[model samples]
Target: MPKWTAADVPNQDGRTAVITGANTGIGFEAAKVLAARGATVVLGVRDTAKGSAAAAQIVAASPGADVRVQRLDLTSLDSIRAAADAIRADFASIDLLINNAGVMYTPKQTTADGFELQFGTNHLGHFALTGLLLDMLLPVPDSRVVTISSVGHRMQAAIHFDDLNWEKSYSRVGAYGQSKLANLMFTYELQRRLSGKGKTIAVAAHPGGSRTDLMRNSPLAFRLAYKVIGRLITQAPSEGALPTLRAATDPNVLGGQYYGPSGLGESRGAPVLVKSSAQSHDVAIQRRLWTASEELTGVKFPV
Candidate 1:
């Protein structure tokens, strides 16, 4: 089948979407397109000012776009809970939840909940937020959850069962790779659990190398390298968002089906169904990760 583009996404007249990190980069682009297509978009972001600005920009670009801003700091459990509560109080249902917020290579730092930064924000935070919003998601027929992983996931050596939090040792790139891998594992496991419960919400998608502010938080050396060499390798943020939009809105998409770019090395192009590494499908590891996540976040899936 041919790769899909944003234009291929069906009309989303009455649907509602919540996009994490919608203040900038690929998430911002995705939110803009969804709102333009008539979906009510809730921008879940860390910075209230930036989120409002992004919403304003989208509304300006697409007049009549139903875009609103909500503060969400994924690294903080208290913030996550508060954001989820606010959404619950305002919306009856959420048709799409895009786990698009993430952290890249950075010096070792812990979240407010003491989790290693990348894994905490990138995986565990979303895991908790999704679980908290399960009631809202379950009522909407054909609702979907799109977890954004990365091509860098392939670099993950293993689950690091003994050191999931990197307490023993930490390498910024390795930790980031592991977190992305965790995203894929979480996506698949979520599909599995939802399927067993007869839920129809599909879960999938991964952006290939995209030039975005995700690099801005990186170490100085990494940021410089990305600034110089990234231009030649990474696609624009708008292009990077296509796979996510396709995953969220494509009627043909099925649960657990991953998508990414079709260009050489899965770096740039329209969104196409892509294969994940064998390690990504390890059920035992996924189960362990899920358990660990629940313990870490103090949030459990109702399944």
Candidate 2:
């Protein structure tokens, strides 16, 4: 059991990967590495212009790298459907799907589909995308789905099945925490369902504290706090991307494994096998969340 690093990522030739929010931050770094390693990387983003620019950057960095950009607004089901349809039409199969797009603390809002913004974009959007793409995923042996969660999940209360939308009471931090927790729960349960199938693996990773634009839309106080304190805590976006890269490419990684920074408080270091909170491992809650997610998204796992 050697600790893994980017060097451990085997050559990814002939593989295809779709990474959400690859236009910037940890997603961008991960995409760049995977494409450089010879995987066909699709940048799933809302802004075509930015996505194109990011793809260009990757191609420039890794000459002859096969990379493209696709439109995907996680906040909208229509966008998710369109992206899936386009990918299915163009590619024979997909090797990896990284649910890496996310939003941090922000003022209360709603997605295009009317769910709370954080939960909708961060958790439900990826949930729907993963479900919709299950057919393609299942047919590809060794395929993987990696969900990105966070340590903030430990600070928040458990999922409020009664009011998942935060209709009763809303708090930005709490919503973000809940959404992150949902990501881990989704990852573990997906692994449980896919167990013994031998076709696909579901895993989760977190960047710890990364200096990315994910917090750009945060409220003033939050922004100021990061401005003053981020230097002491956060790692660079490239450094932050290690856990995701490890999960995506490490051959030794097991299904349902969660990876994160190995430094103090899991904030910054080489990617390492990390433990999720006790609540995140509760099967009953994960099952309920899975059912609720399927019902809410109107998309069932094809497994």
Candidate 3:
């Protein structure tokens, strides 16, 4: 059996990929590969200047690459809507929408819409963006909505229905867990809804233990520990992006399937089909989360 690599990505001519937080790390790596393969890549970023810089980098690497940038601040609903509208105005149909941007452990904070920063940016924001743009995808055969989850999802994670905002208490670790878990549940529920609609499928992937700027928000003690042992356990961003690339482009990928590193503890290595926590497969909870997310974000799916 062969391992999947970026080289395995098929020719993507005429495809349009909108990737969130694509200015750096795994998202950037995925964008570069897809662009090189002839996809018109859109870097959806919070900072337009940074987004343009990232797009320039991609075009520089892949000469003649048709790369564009759209300002997308996931922490705010207005920005998400604006980004979606801008994208729909430019491209009539979208082939891929990769929910790749996220925030890691940070001191307790809230989003522009008053939701917890991690949950709002990581799960709810993508939820709204996807719902807004799914209409364009439904009309295009084989279109995909690939979301980026994390191995952290299984680390004491649950959908905190009672205190979804963590207003009672706050543990950066637990909040992050809730958000990532929501990412998986979202994918499963979305796949169920997309069923019998069209060729569009919902998929999830995780960049198992990659060294990136995502950890900039980590506590000093944890950051110090990572600085000491990170190299031994973590893979590069390019390596981390492999699972997402495979999830987005592999023709054999089925809806609701997950991909992650094949190495020990799924920390680092080539991308392959992987299992998520059993809790992530809870259909009732998934439906509940979907309904809750709709209520929280005021975004309903057309599917």
Index of the highest-TM-score prediction: 3
Root-mean-square deviation of each candidate, in angstroms?
Answer: 1.5, 1.3, 0.7
Per-residue CA lDDT of candidate 3, range 234-293, in tens? 999999999999999999999999999999999999999999999999999999999999
Write the candidate numbers in order of decreasing lDDT: 3, 2, 1
Which model, 1 or 2, shows the larger lDDT? 2
lDDT of predicted model 2: 0.92
Clash pairs (backbone) in predicted model 1 = none
| TM-score per model over all chains | 0.96, 0.97, 0.99
Query: Can you tell me which runs of candidate 3 are displaced by over 4 Å?
Result: none
For 93-127, candidate 1 gives per-residue lDDT tens digits of 89999999998887899999888999899999999
Candidate 2: worst 10 consecutive residues by lDDT? 1-10
